[model samples]
Target chain A: MNVIEARHLWKEYGDNVVLENVSLAVKAGEFITVVGTSGCGKTTFLKLLLGVETATRGDLLLDGKPLPDEPNADRGIVFQRYSVFPHLNVLENVMLGAELAASPFWGRTFGKRRRAIREQAVAMLESVGLGTALLKYPSELSGGMQQRLALAQALIKKPRILLLDEPFGALDPGIRADMHQLILSIWRQTGLTIFMITHDLKEGFYLGTRLWVFDKRRHDPQAPNRFGATITYDIPLGHTDRTTLHTIQQSLGANHD
Target chain B: MKRLINQRPSRAAQVLLGILPFALLLLAYLWASELRLAANPNDKLLPAFSSIGEAIWSMAFEADKRSGNYLLWVDTLASLQRLGLGVLLSALMGLVIGVANGAVPLFRAGLSPLVMALSLIPPMAILPVLFIVFGLGEVSKVALITIGIAPFLIRDMQQRVLELPEEQLIKAQTLGASSWQLILRVILPQVLPRLLDAVRLSLGSAWLFLIAAEAIAATEGLGYRIFLVRRYLSMDVILPYVLWITLLAFLTDYLLRVLTRRSFPWYYNGGKP
Candidate 1:
């Protein structure tokens, strides 16, 4: 069975249809990267997968079962900003997931359980190159470091699906390069099904095993919101050529214009 | 060569500038009092600085012959206790209701408008009602203070919680946080420092309500003493009591500021976390 399967998914906010007829089957361990124009509903699709937004109409199945209406431990998401808890330190941020799971009411664990959570959080942070910065708050870290902390915080829960909403779009190029390498290594080791949305086409191409382009196949100039966006391209990576990339880029630019 | 907007005084200059107005006011008062005294040795309107000094010394240090209690200390303790209890209760209610109304949609829809309406109602207008309901005692006084400022604190805390990024809540939910857990781990921690801020802002009004309540009904509070001496035209006692109240309010605000900075450093430092 596929890890995720969406059949004719449609999301509309009142009359404004955001996503329409988005159908796809994602196998486990597939790193799917989504790219689109600013209002092309890529983020909406990601929200649906994370279960933050429900589909207006369609069948979204997880492991051959209906997707949960709300977010849960099965899915983990890291947004571009405000992803990490501002009040928690680095280690505490990572430990929060386990703590909430263990002591649902108090959101904390004491004694041996807490020590175990600390060790696990430390190891997760160490994997993300934040071992030395465990005591630092998210505000004290640089943008790159904060995103690293966010990633560690998300991954600490051991979710089956990892979702990234333009996680590196705000970082400097040099730092983004390092983040790319780190994320790739983590993905390879975990074999987690990852869905990442990126504005940077090159970054998307570099990190994804599969690439999806969200664009409206039908446009109505008289009624702009008449048609919603759909997956116009679902290209399997590893065989992507320069001409195809240039063609897609030109089309996207034309759509923007 | 810097423009006025760009110019900033040095630390010592800043201190001097801050004290300049108070110094000028004191000098003017002293000169006026001296002139009034030269004209009439028994002038009661503007008491001489020495008389005010003596009043402070006597009230604060010397035990009263009738009660054997230092009037200043007794009044200070009574006022502080009422203000402390009222503000503590207000903070607790504000945090719980604010978090509930801000975070939970059902609670927000049901209670936000009610809280909004309550905040709009003048807390002073209901002072008489409170007196009738709770009797003319410490309960009425403390209840007045709590009712006066709690609505504002609740509104402030709710606004702060609402202003928090939606992504944080979503991220917390994805991390397996239940509704209660989300409030405990995510919303409560973030709102606590902000709650301190709201309480600090509301302290001025809290003091106002406390004084008003005490002036009307209490027998031993600072406000009661001030109003009591007004009949005798005791400007000396009134002035010192007013100054002491101002000092206490300033110290409370300063201590709350320091506590917020020390306890939640991230709250003041850009709030990026």
Candidate 2:
């Protein structure tokens, strides 16, 4: 079954056009990267599929089911910034989704349900090499460690797919590369489908099983007072998908190192 | 010199160093004040430290003679009761209103300005109005403090909740969290640190307002007791109460900071404050 299928999706703000007709099908366990220039609707498309924002006009389905309007425990997302909850240790944050999933009511009353969730979170944190950091706060750790904590948290839920929106975008180049390797290794072991949105071509080429290009657009899709921008492109990866990204100086386009 | 500078003091030593100035000032000020107050016994406005000490001693003596000094504890408890109820009510109400304003588009647009305006008004200005509305009852004092502080807490919380990342909230929703669950889990946890600060700030402010509330409206509270002693020109009684309030505020703030540190050990604070 297709893990994700988005059809003729369009999202816009008052004067910004994020995506015109973004439609793609992600297969199970496939590592797909949506790449574009900065301000390209790559993030928006990811949001649409992840159900962060409503598509102005489109149908988004996951596992042959209707997409949800709000967040669920079924999809795990990691952000560019370490979006770890500052009030929780690495373990609690990782355990959050699983706890929610295991119980209809995620609270102190459901203490027994929490044990299973805790065990799962510990296992996922260990998988991401963060077993020692479980007791550590996100602040006490290095950037790489924080990112790993976030990954542990995301995977702890055991979501069907991982949605990453430039998860390493904010890190320094060296750290970013290290995180990419760590994430790739974790992804291999877990075999969870990954759909990451990035403007970085090199990372995209290195990581993606398949790639889609969202055309650049000068539109603000979330403008509340007014209808936003119009949609633009979905250029396929073509040979870039088959070859090492180093060979595609052309598709790298204006996107820099 | 560089090596000496590089050597950092231990935590205990650092705390000792921090208190050094206060200790020195306490000694120096004691001498200075004694000399000043000795020459000015007739000055009734700012009662002398010695007289206040005497007065506080006498009041304690009287409470012991009359009510076995359980009343002293009771009055202090009474004042704390008002503060506890006032601050808790304000914090919860403020957080609810502030979070509502932040999350809802129309409320965010409409209520933010009104809340800000209310926050800017001197809390004392509303004291008279509170008396008219709530009467000179315990409820009046508690209500006054709540009204005075809730707006600020609400405003701060609103701003914090508003700034919560769209990515994370939406990510959770996409994961299938209901709207209510999103709030209980994602939204609450994200804004908790700031909310804690808000609660602490309100608690301190509530006490500050409590003095005004207690003094004007009622009898049988710490503030009223302080006022009663002031009438007899007893500064010592007032000072201890003041000291007690200060101690409470300090302890509460310290406890909150510790709690924040304990909970969010990974909390890498980027805020300038």
Candidate 3:
């Protein structure tokens, strides 16, 4: 059964259409990676899935029901930067999701419940290689460590779906490689569905079970807003040949440069 | 050859440079006072340092003949109380209104213009109205400080709240935070240090309003005492009082800085809002 399905989803800000007729269905644990040129509504589509944004004119369903218009614990997101709360130390940041979920009124837990959340948070942090930095604040961490903390913070709620918006875009190459391994292992262990947006085509191919390219199918020079981006190519990975990869890379390289 | 900007002074040199101007000013005052006192046996304009010291000693240690109260301590206590209450109330109101205005569009549309208008009005101009409405008492003096600084605090906090990254809010929501939870857990912790900063920035104006209100109506306060002695041309008492108020203001600012550093170490280490 599909965990998420969008039926002709449309999102427009007045005359400026962002995503038009975007429709897709994702099985429960598919790893979908999206790549597009800047301003091509890749992030907007992710926001729609995360429920921070609503489809302007169509249905976005989760588990066969219309997705909530606001974010909830069923889905979690990580941004490229400012994903970790600067005020919270690493352990508190990871514990915050469960704290809010368990105690909605005060956003806190006490004694035994608090102890359990702490242990859970510690385990999550350890999984993300942040166990040693539990007491350190976000500002004290390097960019890579902060992203690890962000992932731990988001995953503590055990969301079925994780949304990552260029979460490793700012990392050094060596650090990003390590992060890619960490994320892949976590995904394999938990069977969590993931939708990641990346600017790097190579990263998309390496990480995703399926890849999507968002591009404008039609253009009007005089009325630029008249046309919106749609999924130009949806390719299943694992069996994709090098010639196809080269063609897609050549087509996207011009815009990227 | 080093550029001017690159030629920073050594530690000792920096300390020397800092004291130079103050030393010069003190010498100038002493010279002028000596000349005035030599020409006239009793010059009221600038008293000798010894006279000022004596005034401080008496006001601080000796009780008043009629009221039997140490005027300096009484005045300090009264002024501190009013300042504390005014600032506390302003901080509370500013945090609530500013967060609401920044986070909720409806609140922003309704209250932002009124806050802006309140901020623009010269607070002193409304002194008469405050005195009339609240009466000539402690309430009026406290209200003056609150009215004088609260709008500015609110506006500053609102801007700080607005300056927070949009991703943080969305990230908090995805973590299953309600709107109230978002404000309490996410927004409030971040805004708190900025609020402290805003309060520190507004302290100068807060002091100005406090003195103005006390001068106009109060019987006992730093401002009241200074103005009361002005009629007699009592430069000794007045100068000491002014110095004392300056010292108090400096100490308050220093304490707040220490508090921010101790409580929210992340604020200083992180990027500016």
Candidate 4:
């Protein structure tokens, strides 16, 4: 069964339409990569799926049920900047999910439950290779470590659908490659449906089982606001290799990076 | 000694540099006082330092003949009480209004402009209104300070909360946090440091309002004592009171800085994780 189903989704802010007629079905365990130019509504689409934003038209269904109005534990997102709470340490950050679930307010879990939650958080931090930095604050970590902390924070909640908005966009190429490998392995082990948006076509093609390209195809320069970005290309990358995608990119002859 | 521009000096040198201006000011004041006192042994505008010292000893240590109260201590306690109450109430109001302004669009739209407009009004100008409404009591003075400083504090807190990245809020919500949970866990903790910062900044104005309120109508306060002594030109007593108030203000600021630093080390670390 498809974990996510968006049927002709439309998003508009006042008269300016940001996204129009974006429809896609995302099955469980599929790594979906969305690649488009800046201002092509990729992030907006992710926001829509995460329920940070509402569609102006059409429906989005999760497991054949209507998506919730607000964000929930079932869907998690990691931004490029890594949205780890600055006030929390590595352990507290990873434990935040269970803490929030156990006690929504004050973030205080006490007694045996607290001990259990701490153990879970500690295990999660260990899994992310942040065991030594357990007491360290986010500012004490490097960019790659911070992103790992962010991933641990999201994954600790055991989300069914994980969304990444260029989570590796800020890392060095080598670190980004390492993160790509880690994320792919995690995806394999967890079998969570992942939707990622990126500007780097190579990175997108390298990781995704399915690729989506967003663009405003019917753009009139005089009144460009009239047209909204739509998913122009949907390519299933399960069989097609990177070389084939690169050739297709050359044929397009545009800045697909 | 060679002085390097922009380079930090040694600890002793830094202390010397900090005290240099104060030393010069004191030297100038003493020189003028000596000249005046030499000419006329009873100049009251700037009394000799010895007389001022004597006044401090007596006012701070000894009880008043008529009222049987150590005037300086009494005044300090009264003024500190008023200032503390005012600031505490202002902080509470600012946190609530500011968070509401940041989190709720309806609340922000309705009240933000009103707060901005209220903040623009000279707080001193409405002193009479507060006195009339609250009466010439501690409530009036405390209320005056609260009204004077709370709006600016609220605005500052609102801006800080608003500037928080949208992703943090969304991420918290996705982690199964409700609106209340998001605020209590996410927004409150982050904005708290900024609130402390804003409070420290607003304290200067709070002191201004407090002194103004007390000076205009009070039987016993630092401001009242200062103004009361001004009539007799008792610079000896007045000068010490002014210094004490300044010392108190400085101590409050320093304590708040230390508290924020100790309580939220992550806040001071620029929120890296």
lDDT of 3 by residue, A138-257 (tens): 888999999999999888888879999999999999999999999999899889999999999889987889999988788787888898899988999888788877878876665446
| Deviation of model 4 at B42, angstroms | 1.2
RMSD of each: 1.2, 5.5, 1.6, 2.3
lDDT string, candidate 2, A1-257, tens digits: 89888787778775555666666777888888777666656676766666667888888888988787655667888887736765567887777666555554553225676776777788888877788877765666777777787788777667888888888887789988788888789878889999888778767766767766565433234543233222232333435544545444454463334
Give the Å shift of residue B111 in candidate 2.
Answer: 6.2
**If you assessed candidate 1 against the hidden native complex, which CAPRI class would it receive?**
high
The docking quality of candidate 3, as DockQ, is 0.65
**Each candidate: what lDDT?**
0.92, 0.72, 0.91, 0.88
Say which prediction, candidate 1 or candidate 3, comes out ahead on lDDT. Answer: 1
What TM-score should be assigned to candidate 3?
A: 0.97
Worst 10 residues of 4 chain A by lDDT: A248-257
Model 1, B1-273: lDDT tens digits are 989999999999999999999999999999999999999989888999899999999999999999999999999999999999999999999999988988888998999899889888898899999989999989998899899988888888888889999899899998899999998888998999999989999999999999999888888999999999999999989998999999999999999999999999888778865
Best by lDDT: 1
Off by over 4 Å in 2: A1-9, A21-26, A58-66, A107-112, A156-160, A171-192, A216-248, A251-257, B1-50, B62-75, B100-123, B229-248, B255-273
lDDT of 2 by residue, B147-226 (tens): 88889889888988877767656656544556666677777766767788778766767877898887876667788888
Question: Ten-residue segment with the worst summed lDDT in candidate 2 chain B?
Answer: B264-273
Better of 3 and 4 by DockQ: 4
* Global CA lDDT computed for model 4: 0.88
| DockQ ranking of the models | 1, 4, 3, 2
Give me the overall lDDT of model 2: 0.72
